[model samples]
Target: MSTIVSARGLTKKYGDFTAVDGIDFEIQEGECFGFLGPNGAGKTTTVRMIHCVSPVTAGTLTVDGSAAGVDNRALKKKTGVIPQEITLDIDLTVYENLLVFARFFDIPKREAKARIAELLKFVELETRRDSKIDQLSTGMKRRLLVARALLNKPRIIIADEPTTGLDPQARHLIWQRLRQLKAQGVTLILTTQYMEEAQQLCDRLVVMHQGKILKAGDPRGLIESEIGKDVVEIRMPPDRDEELLARLGPLACGHERVGDTLYFYCRDGIGLWKALVDLDLPNTVHRPATLEDVFLKLTGRSLIE
Candidate 1:
């Protein structure tokens, strides 16, 4: 796959505070590339530059062979954005909301009508087409947002926290639609705080922190590299951590104590489990290491705010 978006030493600043600081990354065509981070971590800012709405403070940023800038109308024409916020007009029916958006792309009334019908069905909001935006459920509204983004038949789609307030069933439905679009060869750029969302949709991703890239790789690869195959949690008192580590630390690759739990990351979990059982420790859990483990390990377990 060819590079669809590339950034070298990219920087974004508002006044003296920098949001993105000299980060470099590349996005491949027809892949779901994700930007994962905590709140105010510049994931949104980086994608904003990619979509050409926010200007780069300094750096070489290019999308589809053209330099990215706020004035790049040609680039904007082929890019679709599913914003984090629900920006639909409450007074308009779902169909009218899409109609107004389609007009922005200069799509003719006849073509817009045809495209809107197709998109509504694709998002499973066909029955809600004439329903007012305010009358729809949160899931229905989010699905409508997905349809609105596709009006331009874009080559690239940016989804920023697309399933913020959605339930499991609703979120999965959106995921299916996104996967369908990607299978059709649309390049997907996603920014999200949900680790499951990233693992589900992204073929590859970059984890951002304080305007910098901490790690970049496929979800499973990152999990394996940063955290081993299994994790053991012993919810003993903090004072007993040293005693427990002394007994089981050699079997695990690494250990950390957070709150009342001592976490053991290991490739050889069987040995670790056996050791814990021999010790007859209570409140012990051995589980598979996941993307969330890698995320917290890199980003720190503390609240970002």
Candidate 2:
């Protein structure tokens, strides 16, 4: 597959803080790629630069082989962006809002209407076409934003924290539409703090922290390779660190103590688990290493604020 988006030594600095520090990655055609990190981890900032809204302080960025700055207008026309916040014209009805986006791409009169109708159906908002944006539910507004983003039939779509404020049902609905877009061959680069969202929607991802790439690969591969196939958490009293480490040390492939939580990563956690049981550790739980496990293992922090 051809590379749709490419970044080399991409860097972004605000004052003394470096948001994206010389990171590089390629987003291939027809792939759902993600930037997974918590707040201030540079995911949003990187997305903005890729969307051509934020200029890179140094290094190179290219969309479809054109320099991000040299061909921004063309790049913007070829890409769709759903920002962290909804930017729709809430005063306009659903149909009108979509039509407006189509017009922005310079679609002709007859073409814009046809495309708008199609998008409404694609997002399952056809029944609410005539409703005002604010009159729609929060989920409806998010769906409309996605529908509007598809107005130009962009090759690449960038979403920044797309499901941040949505409920479970609404989030699932949006994920469904995103899968539809992927099936239609739209390359997606999404920045999300939600691990499940990333795991379910993104085929591959890069987990970033402190303006650097912490790890990048297939979601399951990252978990399997970085942490392991499974994890066993032993919540112990703060002062019991020495004893707990001594008991878990032999079985753990790698383990760390963070506050009251001890994270143990190993394949076949059964052996490690048995050791813990024999030692009679307090508040023990054993589970598979999810994307969440990899994130915390790499950063020693939670994804949510």
Candidate 3:
């Protein structure tokens, strides 16, 4: 696929403070590209620059062959944004909210009406079209936001934490719609804290921390590369670290102690599992390595705040 978004040494700053510290990455066309990080890790800052909302303080960012900047109307016209916040007009009905947004893109009223009808059905909100925003549930509001973003028929869609504050059913509905868009060849740029969301939607992604890209790869590939195949967590007292390490450490590729648990990372857990069983240790959990494990291992398990 062709590159839709490209950044090199991209940086963002607010006076004396830098939010995005010279990161570089590329997003391919028709693929769901994700930015994953903790709060204040510059994920939002980076996407804001990509969508041309925030100005770049340094380096270069180009989207669809044009330089990304605040004044780039052509770029803006081709991009749609699903903001992290619920920015819907509460006083307006669901259909009205999309109607006003279509006007901003200069979409003709007749065409806008046709598109709105299709979008409401696309997002499964057809029955609630005349309902006020306050009458819709959180999930319905989010679905409407998705439909609103589509009014312009954007080539690229930027979704910042799109499923935030949603239950599983609601979140899955958004995911299905996003996947459908990807299938139809819309380039998706996503920034989310949910690891499962990233794993589900992203064709490729980068993990950012402290204003920098720490790792970038396919989800499963990154997990295997950074965290091996299996993880065994033993929730024993911290003092048992030496005893556990002396017996099981050699069978595992890596080991770490956090809080009251001893984590063993290995390519194959059969040996580690047997060793643990022999030792008959209590509170032991052996499971497959996941994207979350890689994330925590790279970013540290401690709270970012």
Candidate 4:
């Protein structure tokens, strides 16, 4: 696959505060590339520049051989954005909402009508076409937002927290649609807080914190490289941590104490489990290491405000 989006030392700032520091990454054509970070990690700002909605303060960002900038109409024309916030006009019916957006793209009435019908069916909102935006449920509204973003046939789609505040069924529906788009060869740029969402869609991703790219790789690879095959959690008092570590630390590849839990990251949990059983610790959990473990370990377990 060819590189569709490339950023080198890309930076974004507001006044004296730097939201996105000098960071670099490349998104290949027809693959789901994700930006994963906690709040205020510049994931949103980075993508805003990619879709040409926000101006780049420094360095270079190019999409499909064209420089990405606020005034780049050609780049914007081929990019579709599903914003984090629901910007639907409640006064208009579902069909009218898409119709107005089609007009923004200068789509002809005949073509717009046909496209709207197809998008509505694509998002499974065909039955709610005539309903007012306010009359639809939250899931229906989110689905409509997805349909609206497709008003213009776009080669690249940027979804910012597309499943925010959605139920399991709704979130799965959106995930399925996104996967379908990827299968159809659309380049997808996603920024989401949901670790499961990133694991489900992204072929590769970067973890950002304090305006820096800390790590980048495929989900499973990152987990295996940074963390091992399994994680053993022992919940106990802080005072007992030293004794536990001295006993089991060598049995595991690594260990860390965060809050009440002592995390033992290891390739095989059998020895660790036997060690724990020898000690007879009551509060212990052995489970497979996941993307979430890598995320928390890289970003820190504390709250990010």
For every model shown, what is its TM-score relative to the native structure?
0.98, 0.93, 0.98, 0.98
| Model 1 C-alpha lDDT versus the unseen true structure | 0.94
Model 1, 126-237: lDDT tens digits are 8887998889999998999999999999999999999999999999999999999999999999999999999999999999999999999999999989999999999888
CA shift of 42, model 4, Å: 0.3
How many steric overlaps are in each model, in order?
0, 0, 0, 0
lDDT, residue 100, model 4: 95
Tell me the spans in candidate 4 whose CA falls farther than 4 Å from its real position. none
Q: What is the TM-score (0 to 1) of candidate 3?
A: 0.98
Task: Give the CA lDDT, 0 to 100, for residue 64 in model 3.
Answer: 99
Predictions: Cα RMSD each: 0.8, 2.0, 0.8, 1.0
Off by over 4 Å in 1: none
Model 2 bad stretches (over 4 Å): 279-282, 302-305
Error of 2 at 104 (Å): 0.8
| Total backbone clashes of candidate 4, pairs 3 or more residues apart or in separate chains | 0
Q: lDDT of candidate 2 vs native?
A: 0.87
lDDT of 4 by residue, 208-277 (tens): 9989999999999999999999999989878987788888999999999888888999998899999888
Candidate 1's displacement at residue 150, Å, is 0.5
**TM-score-best of 3 and 4:** 3
Minimal lDDT window, size 10, model 4: 237-246
Q: Note the residue pairs that clash in candidate 3.
A: none
